[model samples]
Target chain A: MSTTATLPGGPGRQSGQDILNLVLTVGLLPVLMAIVIIGTSLMSPYFLGWMNVVNILRMASFLAIIACGQAMVIIAGGFDLSVGAVVALASVVTAKAMAAAASAIGGPDILAIVIGIAAGLGSGLAVGLFNGLCVARLKVSGFVVTLGTMSATAGIGLLLTNGIPVYGMPKGFVQAIGRSQILGFPLAIYIALAVVLAMAFVQRRTLFGRYVYAIGGNQEAAVVSGVSIRRHLVGTYVLSGGLAATVGILLTALVGSGQASLGGDAMMLQSIAAAVIGGVSLRGGIGRVEVVAVAALFLTILGNALNLLHIDSRLQPIFLGLIMVLAVALDEFSRRRMSRV
Target chain B: MSDADLAAPAKPAAIDARGSRILQGTGWARQLALPIALVLLLAGFGLADDRVLTTYNLLNIAQQTSYLALFAMAQMVVILTRGFDLSLGPTVSMVSVAAALAMAGIGGADANGIVAVLAAIAAGFALAAACGLFNGVVVSILGVSPLVATLGSMNIAIGVATTISDGRPVQGVPAAFADLFYRGSILGLPIAIVIAILVGGVLAFVLSRTVFGRSLYIIGTNPQAAAVAGIPVKRLLVYAYVLCSALAALGALMMTARTGSGEPNLGGTLSLQSIAAAVVGGTSLAGGRGGVGSAALGALFITILSNGMNLTRIDGYVQMIVLGAIVILGVVLDRLRLDGR
Candidate 1:
């Protein structure tokens, strides 16, 4: 919001310098992405294979879905570290609820799955709303608030499952929908793409999206201009929570079980990395959903490339860390350059 | 959910400013709040188990608390300057692996083994210091946000550690290495405890009696004002991060020695736990308002709660939930103090 607001642009107008700047900054992700893909294909026979592409997209879809919410939260001037934890929590609760509903009420698999998903998403929203209340009402910093929720929510999930993977989800859920493919691609790919497109629509052409950008871009002006900072911030958190739960439930279905440690697998950092790489301003009020999806895709492909190249998987975080730092550093420098101008 | 790296901008106090107040907390801070809570926890746990109050168990708690105390101090130092060091935990993990791998490279434990241990310690400290330096430069010189800078460093350190150890614990260090740093006693106190006390004492003195400490608070409160007063803001921030990382490394090294191995995953929960301790102990996330004393108290409180819960056979997941709740409670308590004022 801040960056684009200062730039000379309207919806159908093109300026040479703006295009150049966009290409250099946000546009660079796709360029790097192409280079990675081509370079990996050259280096490894398996890189461009059909199976690998599907697998990469499936992985990217999960991250992209969660990161969409992350980007929204960032655009609204808040951060939710608990997104990953929400994933795990949702997974656990969904499985638990699905199992309980099936046994207690003797319901059909579809009903059980629906119950599980609702339970999962409901818990996620509860966690998000709770975090929002703490941040908005109690005025705790978002980091600390979400940090606490991350632990507490995840702990609750783990406690419910006793540190074990929850398995009682119906078999058909995994077979028919969870692992199903459509048009030679995994169903997750379609779901992810749909989510990305919908979010892009909401972010670009919706009143709520405008309010979020206004809030993050300038809170003082937002307040003066009649935006309910608290309400909007809480609403953003709810959406983030809901998305994280979606990932959790989807991953649970994919794995055919709910594992409490899913979120601990560095999911939080990766989600944030996706958002940052997509050019979501840390100061808030700046981002593009389509760009974020690309960022997530690039990250998945990069990891796949490393694996295909026989790089030690243990050292993967180094690449992620370097890229994240570089992206952030670039953002800072660009912002400084713009502010100077 | 981790450390300083993910601490989003906006202090709890600065967020809402006014309106919400649960109660008027007494005293300049309700100074007795943390201590009273500590006493209640200790007493409750002691009553739940006869062995809890034993000198042996008390010593055990002290030894464990020492590490957390060290980490809390490290976090406090950075938070004092409006900086976050999520990398502290990873620094510990990376340093542990580096130190262990370095020591493992040397053959048998002989007269030369003493020199080998010193060399291992140096290697660990060097790696930790290097990480700190990188975080400092990125945040201050490059104008990157502290959260992202430290987050990147965290992942990088974790990657290096995993690379060195192949994601497993590195073994085969000399028994004497553990003896000198962790097992050996100074006047019947664990060496780790003694070292923690000495470090805390020195830090307390430095923070209270030095120009650097004063400048840190000044810079944290208002960078512009500090610059106008001729404070070398960037350098001091760098120093704070370096100090934070180094201190965390010391704690990690001690724990690594005690385990007689370098654990690549050693830093997993330390980030959240240390931040929890710091905030609970009364260190302000807003910066410019916390010290070693409060951080130590926070660590002590957390340690006691965990140890007591263990003594009474409480689940680890429950501990995580309660610990996370304490972090939020601490902030709410902080706000209440402000409201009281």
Candidate 2:
């Protein structure tokens, strides 16, 4: 483990090999984003427009938020397939609570909004708790646990709304959070940016983050070194669940209704793709949130650009899939090159 | 003194041997948790609704479970090697489209009747196998993680499926084809059920008795150890993916037959369903410890649950919740069994 200076815990160095891997991992996203920008600009005159760019940014914000959480989970050597379902659950719960609150108060009250948000976010927290306990305590695989939770939560969401969208959210709240722009961009972009920055800091400078990398790098080593694997692993999942819930609420605002199937499975898939394209290893313990943010933008832009070019929306997944495979291949190539050196 | 003393000692030894045999039986019982639950469920549902135990309902379950049984086999094979193929669902969708297009004529809606139907079925399997080959190459040769590699392929397959089918369902298949594969029955058994049983039996034999099967378990248990022991780990893994995809393709064709149309969106639930069935059947997500028979049994169990729910007029959403809970419960039980050992 020490031989690979590319590891986060390795001794500080300006080694050439280390620098190469860093460039491949951290620098790849921006280069790809630039290429996408240039290509899209060439393909469509509207691609370079500020309005279009902002539109892409706003859309990418939701994905970026989810990807940020997913990046942490991946770095901690875990995967969460239930984030999409958590989003739906949060959306329905929040919308339902807020609707009831609005009716009792004869309008949307501040207290009602607070209660609604808490209930929504708490639902997410509960899901995380269950997943964390099962994975960490019962020792179940994260993939299986999350897959089960995803389906179960989605079912709960559907039951809450009976497949109907909950309408009648306060118009002011929707406009303020979902429709209105702040500082030339939607509120969601700012929230996503804040999350990215905070998570990046946590990953770089916090003991919890260090423990996550350690656990992912080598669980036995981490345990031998007195790190609490269960705590960190469970915490990572909880954080991911919270973030997914936030996205769900944001989606509700954007859509002006509480949808039981908001985001669905596509959101989870895109989040994983964005994180991978940003150089997060599915093998775990190596990624940067900043790059993930850019990757999220690139993915969102790629889809938007395809739509602008009049390509069928159904064909969009193919490009995203191609990019994911290529990105992982590049990551693998870099890792191999580093090892050889 | 010699005869009497010797007889007394032998009697105690025989008793000890019987005691140990009972303990071994309990171990087997632990492994049969899912099966036991299935039997209990059947008894309860049958008691509640006499129709559930009727020949027609039982046959319906057999027919319904056939596709999932095939999928579970495919998933079990891959999981046996500690790999996942998330693209299985999309592969089915793509194969469905390919077969439909072939039957609908390459260019126009002109069916060549029997020849075209046979050719279309063959084309579907070939396409599915090709998709599996792609997954294998990416995972084994490129060394990408199975999760990411299969995910990328899934997106690509889904895109291709929707594009080729023009996002619409193709319905030009001859009625005779569907009848033979789906509706036809022999000895009061649906052909689909017969095919599933035959395939399951063959796969179970291969996994238990073949060198290839043993190699897969060895690699899945510990790849480095398997490599050191002279197994061609990479090649076997590739074969596993290919086999999995081929099985998925067969399921896809069955789905097309059952639905009597080629749907671009068919099998959206397949990846999850297959994984659930495999896991429920005691196939460890960690790999190396499951058989084809268990997987088929698991599929039957799931089918029975669904069929029972429908018969009892249980809400679909509630059924989803129950099924999801069952997946988690199965995994938890498996974990407990392992820990006990």
Candidate 3:
């Protein structure tokens, strides 16, 4: 872990230690994924099979999309506890809309699919808008705003679902979102890749992204530089909400039902973990979406490896928790060292 | 480092808040809001159902408030220090399950059951200590932020608990144990209520009177200042996290008694709910500005809201929305008060 990337001399005249820290922070996950892959393949014959690889990618896609959204909020120096709830609520709304549309039209129809997707995305956007307004306009803490939304979203989800799963979506929606394959890959995986790529571009190349980073890095500096902190923050939050809703809608299509519990606590926590592990700084103004998506992939691979190794599903969380702590601590330590330099 | 450095910024802010308190009216209104809202809530509930104000129901509210009061304080301890334990809910679940599992494993109802109960509580505390120590070390010694550290540990705790309980409720608790501890009264007050009061008194006294508590606030407010003042910032932070985990375990113990079983799912909502209570009671998430009294008030507020809503026959789903709304309201008012100052 302490070894450098062996290309220490950069244009900025960085040292070997700086290169080492960079490798430790950014490259550790890929290394871990490789190690897990090798270890699991040795332990189980089927671990590295094509079907298993595809399965892992499919599972990873959901979390990747979520991490993409969460990274934006975090980069803006905000938190969103409501992502899981948003997922649940959006899922319920999407499923319900699809079911209603199908029934009203007296058959399976493309309109139902359109209505469901639109409803899911809309709800997510609405939550994002609300969170953004509260944080930026109302001047409430982002933590508080998101916490309230998380609870309310869950409640609304439950109210809609009545503690029962809402089923009967248009078949086309599920087939398209869940099972559609291009070059032997699920459509959801492609969607996740697109989201990850788009988010990465936004974070790296866009003016809005630069403004978000500036605001999060130092609000006073950003303000002095003529950035509108309020507007940027609102935009980041709204984007976060909208992205989470996308996942909710996708999950609904995949499951062919809407469940208030669809976005479990694990999903929320894991998304945050994936973001942090992917090198996104919790304090803001750091991290890349492409990296975060890979981190999510790393997590999925790790989970799959654990299953192949026959680790009890229940014990996996303990490992995950420990790994998350280690990852964040590693990130913190490297950041400290880099700052001192 | 001079006295003026501390007193300079502190005095004017104090004066400003005081000035606003006397003039702006919103300053005072925010302070009065909790009690006022509480009174109105009770009155409305009482009006809707004459039985809501009866002695039995009032006492019932007190009894119901006990565990939540503990939970709020548990969260408040860390919140006072500019950190929070997202792992608390899982801590509750783990402790409850651990205690119940220990007692159930022992199988004997004899020997005054004190030994068995003591052993069970010890098991719970041991688990609590692990969680606290892990969080403290990861956050304080390793320099990770509380959010990442606790979020990771939360997953681990959840996994450990669910695994231990086989993802099912553990119900072999001695009938006598639950009956005596959960239902038995001391001096006409429910034992749980008595314990809550005693703990609240102790925590309050500690926060107001002890060097440890004072240092915690200082560290939370500004670590550099705390270090300059010769406080053991790292060690105390660890202690604060430990204290948080232990108190959360105590709440879990109470919950276990109330439920008469060990439940892995018991604390799924506790983390957010306790946070909601603490903030509502006047605790700031920014830290260094709340106490046990505030925690008590917050817990009381939550309990009243829930109980009153029940009395009014509002659906549970709507109660969740109201709870979310109240949490947001609390933070908004806090923000306004700060701005006014």
Against the reference, the lDDT scores of all candidates come to 0.84, 0.85, 0.85
Name the docking class for model 3.
medium
Candidate 3 C-alpha lDDT tens digits along B139-254: 89999989989988888899999999999999878766676668888989988999999998898767755788767767767889989989988999989989999999988888
lDDT of 2 by residue, A1-341 (tens): 34564455534544655665666756666766777788879989999899998889988999999999888889878899999999999999998998888778874466667767788899988898889889999989888899999989999999989999998667766877788888788899999999999999999999998888888888999999999999999998999899999999898888988998797899999998988998888777888889898899989988888899888888888888988998898889877877887
The residue-level lDDT of candidate 2 at B280 comes to 86
Residue ranges of candidate 2 with Cα displaced over 4 Å: A1-27, A106-108, B1-26, B106-112
Q: Candidate 3 — which residues are off by over 4 angstroms?
A: A1-26, A105-108, B1-27
RMSD to true structure for each model, in Å: 6.2, 7.2, 5.0
Ranking by lDDT: 3, 2, 1
Model 1 interface CAPRI class: medium
lDDT of 2 by residue, B1-341 (tens): 11111112212475346435534543655756677788999999998888999987887887888889899999999998999889999998999989988887743344436777787888998888788888898999999999999999999999999999998999887776787678788787788888888888788667765778777877877899989989988888889999999998888888898898899989799898999998887777887767776678788888999999999889999988998898999899778866764
What is the DockQ score, from 0 to 1, of model 3? 0.70
**Worst 10-residue stretch by lDDT in candidate 2 chain A?**
A5-14
Q: TM-score of predicted model 2?
A: 0.91
lDDT of 3 by residue, A80-140 (tens): 8889999999999999998999989865488788888899899999999999999998888
